[model samples]
Target: MRGEAGLPPVDMSVKVGPLALPSPVLVGSGTFGFGEEYAPYCDLARLGAIVTKAVTLRPREGNPGPRIWETAAGMLNAIGLQNPGLERFLAEKLPPLVAAGHVVIVNIAGHDVEEYVKLAGALDAAKGVAAIEVNVSCPNVSRGGIEFGRDPAVLGELVRAVRGATRLPLIVKLSPNVSDIVPLAAAAMEAGADALSLINTLLGMAIDARQRRPRLANVTGGLSGPAIKPVALRMVWQVWQALRPPIIGMGGIMTGEDAAEFMLAGAAAVAVGTANFVDPTSASRVAAELEDFCRGQRINHVSELTGGLQV
Candidate 1:
């Protein structure tokens, strides 16, 4: 299809394992809520997919007051995976997005391996779930609260179990707090992950100088935004070089150029996270901007940007 001004349309469709997306710009989980929340701001159909917020087996109230703190170029959050639980998600949340004909990739977190398996199994049976993004950033209750993604062995086991439970395309969301991310990425892929989500939030903290207290009630929270873009890009490059698996890159992506940077670093697709809070229409805007970038570079396919970086 051609766009306005007699410009040829850039083919934006991308594949994340078995799931195919209309665009490479997806709204990251937790930031976009469910797809309907942003209906008034942008066209949902323009997005690659809507990754729903992390859903648990039961309802959660999330973190206490002071859950958010703005930093120099990013923000910290300890929302604690607040959600209305699995049953409600299937019965209520999933239906609307599917009914609207939006591609839905559900982000799920569990305290244990069994919980992960159960959640995956349930989603496998549900209609309209294009994929499952395993949020291994959540603490593993069975392992002294150490994040599942922090330990390669544990993450592998978890992914293996989830893989067995569902036939859906599986994407593991890796944590950036690790000493090296390549091992974790390898583990996920070896365990049957179709794709990897590079760099979840980095661990960070803030303090109230005068009061001598921590800024967030949780004492530490996940840091995200422009400040982490370089780190995220580096990680994506390292993992892409090491494993070459499809990566859904995210972290401080505020513009199309930012998304392009990730693509060059080896991300098959990009997700808009912290930027969503800044502009509800950020994902769609990024998609348009990426197409514009392709046109300027005389690139016919958006996929051509992936791993196009020059040493």
Candidate 2:
């Protein structure tokens, strides 16, 4: 038991190929700021990793106003991958976050494969980027968005190019909006991916019948939070069984039980996304509950439960 630190004795250290995480509760890419915004609400070091909001080659002003839509069990957002781009991130945002002890990861988006490679190379040299989460899967925005993630060929080539660019471990986030995940997962592995993170938010929308307008100004946004948990779980289980690489799973996980189910299904770690926006303490609570679960189950290390299900 790690005493006085609110950590349990389960020893939840996880390794993604060569990268390591302290716990299984990682804050999701788009929802969590560059490991800074959540600082006031959380002990950033307590997380498995902190994935910054999706960063692009050039700074983004993000989508037009009214980008969020609230629903019964979740939220839909088309934040449009708002970021300060690589140069500004390195110069202005990254240093303090990492120095504060958060395990830093740069989540990168690109308009093309070459852009990904360039950003990867840049982050590889930037101070304190522990890893790179390739977001070739976001579907909310237009342009070279979900196209790269849906096709196995494009996915493979893009991953290979970025893999070639950085010395840091690669975690390619996969979109669930695909016909089949196996081929794409296979393509990523063959392209030198060190790890795989699955189930970027599914495409969804809400409408105001009276006003005859979409709730979100973007019309369609990526769905996340409680409502998508089942879909996320099924995809994580399928990809975990199909692909041999270590997996980081996420979708609608808001509770410790939700997080634990993903772990049982084969996720090496779970990212708590939409819940962060709903309940700032959601991630921390899940982490606590997971530790309690391991204790009750008599498991010493959380890694022992990784893909532990028997076929």
Candidate 3:
């Protein structure tokens, strides 16, 4: 098919393991609500997928007031996995996105292995779910409330158990708070994760010097946005070099060039997170911009940009 200005269409389709996405640009979970909320501002179908916010077994009230604080070129959030829980999500959230023909990748979190198993099993039968993204950044109550992604063993066990519960493709979202990300990425892959999502916000804190208090009520929150882009890119490069697992790269991506940077570093797909807050149409815009980038580079397929970075 011919593209804009009589140029040949740049193939934008990508396969993150078993999941085939029409575009490489996906709106990150928690940033884009269940998918329908941004319909008026952007075309949901034009994007790769809509990764829904983290859902747990039970409803969570999230964190106290001032859960979000804006910082230099980024933002800190301790939303505490706030959601309406599984039942409501399957009933209320999933249907609308599916009805709208949006590829829905549900992000799930839990306090322990059993909860994750239960969630995976439940979602296995839920129609319209394209895949399940295991958010290992959540606390594991059985492990003294430490984040599941912090330990390679714990993350592997979690992924293994979830893998057994469902036949759906599994995407493990890794935390960037670790000392080295390669071990955790290897563990997830060995445990049967079909794809990996890297650098899920770095741990950070913002203090109010004037009030001598923390800016966020949670004291510390996940830091995201342009400030973390370099770190995210590095991690993605390291993991890809070591394991080469299908990766969904994210962190401070605000434009097409940013997405291209991640792809060059070996991300099979890129997700837009913090940028959504600034522009609800950011995801769709990024997709278009990525196509423009591909055309400008004389690339025939977007996949050609994957791991194309030179030393």
Q: What is the C-alpha RMSD of each candidate to the true structure, in Å?
A: 1.7, 2.1, 1.8
Model 1: per-residue Cα lDDT over 226-299, one tens digit each: 99999999999999998889999999999999999999999999999999899988999999899889888888
Q: Between the candidate structures 2 and 3, which one is better when assessed by TM-score?
A: 3
Candidate 1: segments with Cα more than 4 A from true spot: 1-4, 139-146
Poorest lDDT segment (10 consecutive residues) of candidate 2: 1-10
lDDT, candidate 1, equals 0.89
Query: Can you write out model 3's per-residue Cα lDDT over 37-153, one digit (the tens) per residue?
Result: 788998787799999998889887887868889999999988888889999998898898888888889998888899999999999999989999998864312221247888899
Evaluate model 3: give its TM-score.
0.97
lDDT of each structure? Answer: 0.89, 0.85, 0.89
Better lDDT candidate (2, 3):
3
How many clashes would you count in candidate 2?
A: 1
How far residue 158's Cα lies from its native spot in candidate 2, in Å, is 0.4
